[model samples]
Target: MQLEARKIGFYYKKNRWIFRDLNFTIDAGEIVGLIGPSGCGKTTFGRVLSGYEKPQEGTILLNETPLPKRGYQPVQLVYQHPEKAVNPKWRMEKTLHEGGEIDRELLEVLGIKQEWLSRWPNELSGGELQRFCVARALRSNTRFLIADEMTTMLDAITQSQIWHAVLDIVKQRNIGVLAISHEAALLKRICTRTLTIH
Candidate 1:
């Protein structure tokens, strides 16, 4: 399986292209890093790849086909801000189960305590909430993961734990990962190859 962005272009305003004619691909089981300076549209590209936003030109293809308009998307995105990603009204358990049934082993690997599941999103620390967001995005149907600065805000220990769990799952499931971040050391540690946006 492969997720390919073919000659894609996007802009939020007229005559201002954040990125143009960009082509990229991530094959199944590969970990690709997207690294660039701040405000270079790396996050925008991730959104487009994950089907959260539409590109102004070109296409995003999964296995040479356009992405599905509805239903569970194979390309999932885990953003940097878990607080903004989840609903405030729902408990952590509900949010975690939104994608599908929660994998007990996954929870244990990510260091998510069973007691935390009963708490609200606002009740958890940033790192704790992010673990849930990561877990939710790794549902069985996910073919690719677009992690846009997913661990940037967490401390070194938390970041290491999350990446360890994520990489383990990626290897076991053969899921491709697109890691977007400005941290060169982190990228070098986890990604097989790196793509620069600018």
Candidate 2:
């Protein structure tokens, strides 16, 4: 899927307005980074692009086809915090199972061990949890990925490794990515384009 947000604007009952007339497009084999201050709606914008939110105005299109108001397929979101993103009771295998038919090799390529798949979420480290989260996302036939502050919590080494993992997925899958990050240098290293929001 190729994603395009056209003049989008959004407002939630709990907060101020966001994305006042924004515009951008990202296709397969490209990564676009979004940067902004906290609460400037960078994550919210990612959610909207990933089909988690519907904007009040403007269009969200995939391959020039108007995306539905709800239920987007073949696109997935990887959140900033992995611990909160996953279910405490669910085993690693269970989470990836939800996405269905995932190759065990894919997990290995993401730096996940097969033995660890049987463990619960709480047993994993921050970086390991994030890898599980990514594995879950990749289990689906996702063509567009929205990585909202995905590497902000990990150490520099793990962050770099995971960034490369994501890049590898994009390359092999011929996917498009909307990577939300505040670190300009790091974002530049991975993304083909970067847009700073407010």
Candidate 3:
């Protein structure tokens, strides 16, 4: 399977385009790196691809079909900020299971403690909250993941741990990944190839 962005165009305002007529693709099991300057719409592109936002023009296709509008989305997105992605009112466990019943093995692999599940989002550290986010994005039906600076805010050790778990899961499930970040070294180490946009 492959995810393709064909002639994609997006803009916040009428004439100003964050990106226009862009084309890109990532095959299953491929870890593709996306790098660009600040305010270039990389994050916006990810949101569009994952069905969080609609493109003003063009289409995002999965295996030549439009993304399913209902049910679990095959394309999942993990943003840079975990705090913003999750609900403060819900406990970690509720937030984690919002999609469905998450596998215990996945929780174990992500280093999510049983006790942390009962606590609110604020009670946990950034890394811990982000762990739940990553696990949530890796449901069995997820065919692709758009990791927009997913681990940028964490320490080096925390970053390594999260990446290790995520990489292992994606490889096992043959899920495609588009890792958007500013770190060239990280892209070099994790991605099969890197794509840059202006």
Candidate 4:
């Protein structure tokens, strides 16, 4: 499988393009890194690729077909802030199961505790909540993952652990990953190749 973005363009204001005429691709099982300075529209491009936002021009294709309009999306996005991703009203268990049946092995690998499932979003630490977010994005139907600064806030050890778990699952499932971050060393360490926006 491959995720391709062709001739993409986006803008928030008239005559102001966040990015335009962009093209990129990520083949299955590839770890691709996207790096640029802050406010460079890397996250916006990730959103467009994941179908969270429609590009003003061109198309995003998954293996030469348009992204699915309904049902579970093949492309999943795990954003930087897990707190903002979850529902404040729902318990951790509900949020985790939102995508589908929870995989026990995945939960264990992500270090998600059984007791944390009953707690609210505020009750868990950022790292714990991010584990749920990451696990939720790795559902059976997910073909590609857009990790937009996914672990920027975590401590070094926690970040390493999460990345290790994510990479393990990516290899096991052959899921393509578009990792967006400003850390050059991280990109060099994990990505097969890196693309710079500017």
Candidate 5:
């Protein structure tokens, strides 16, 4: 399987492109890194790739076909801010299972305590909440993962834990990963190959 962005272009304001004519691709089980300075469209590209935003030009394709408009997304995106990604009203357990059945093994690998499931989002630290987000994104149907600084806010230990779990799953399931980050050291440590934008 492959996810390909062909000549993609996007912008918030009219005619002022954040990125233009960008092209990228990743194959199954490949961990690819995307590096760029802030405001250079690294996150925006991840958003477009994961179908969160429509590109002004070009196409995002999965195996040469367009991404599905509705239902479970094959390409999952886990961004930096776990707080923004979740629902404030729901408990962590509900949020965790919102996509599908809970995978207990996954929770264990991510170091999610069973007790935390009963607590609200605000009850957990950013690192703890991020573990849930990462687990949520790795559902069985997910073929590609777009991690936009997913562990950037966490401490080194937490970051290492999360990446280990993600990499294990990616390898076992043959899931492709696109890790978007500004940290060169982190990218060098985790990614098989790196791509720079701008």
Candidate 6:
């Protein structure tokens, strides 16, 4: 998977531009970090890259082509708030099942047992909830992942676990990861390549 953004412009409100004529390209087998001050549209940029939001101008091309808005395609997004990422009514199993049937091996890597899979989102703690969210995102078939502050709510140890897991996924799958965050220390810890936005 390859993502290229050129001269893109976006904004949430009047007279303020989040990204203007911004440009970057990430090839397969690479991890790109997007960092900036708060509300500089780092998450917004991640959304546009993942095809979850539209950019006011410019485009996000995957494999040298534009991505369709709807399909059984890949490229999953794990947002900052796990509460919003996973359905409150759905069980953990339901979350991982979206990409397909559950992979037993992945659960082991995430240090989660099958029992917890049946529980509702509310049943899990913040860290656990986000981990399950990661599990679900990994089940997708896409070769790229946009993680927008997905581990911000967790403790240091939990954050470490999530970051390592994500990096492991990237290495094993040979996929590109676009990790968005305002935490410079965290981004530097995981990203082989990083860029500051705005």
Q: How does candidate 3 fare on TM-score?
A: 0.98
Worst 10 residues of 5 by lDDT: 99-108
- Which clashing pairs does model 2 show? none
lDDT of 3 by residue, 1-198 (tens): 999988988888886888889899999999999998988788998998898888888999999999999999999999899999999999998999997989999999999999999999999999999999999999889999999999999999999999999999999999999999999999999999999987
Model 2 worst lDDT window (10 residues)? 66-75
Pairs that collide in candidate 3 are none
Q: In lDDT terms, how accurate is model 3?
A: 0.94
lDDT of 5 by residue, 1-198 (tens): 999999999999999999898889999999999998888889889999999999999999999999999999999999999999999999999999996896799899889999999999999999999999999999889999999999999999999989999999899999999999999999999899999988
Question: Model 2, which residues run further than 4 Å from truth?
Answer: 68-72
How well is each residue in 1-198 modelled by candidate 4, as lDDT tens digits?
Answer: 989999999988876999999999999999999999889999999999999999999999999999999989999999999999999999999999995897899999988999999999999999999999999999888999999989999999999999999999999999999999998888899999999997
Cα lDDT tens digits, model 2, 1-198, are 578988888889645677678888988878888888888998888888877888888888888877655443667899889999888888988876774668877788899998888999889899999998887787646888898889899999999999888788779989888888888888889888888888
| Residue 92 local lDDT, model 6 | 80
lDDT of each: 0.94, 0.84, 0.94, 0.94, 0.95, 0.80
Deviation from truth (RMSD, Å), model 3: 0.7
Q: What total of clashing residue pairs does each candidate reach?
A: 0, 0, 0, 0, 0, 0
Give the Å error, residue 143, model 3. 0.6
For model 4, what is the alpha-carbon lDDT of residue 154?
95
Residue-level error in angstroms, candidate 5, position 17 = 1.1
Off by over 4 Å in 6: 14-16
- Candidate 1, 127-166: lDDT as tens digits: 9999999988988899999999999999999999999999
Candidate No. with top lDDT: 5
Q: What lDDT would candidate 4 get against the real structure?
A: 0.94
Which consecutive 10 residues in model 4 have the weakest lDDT in total?
10-19
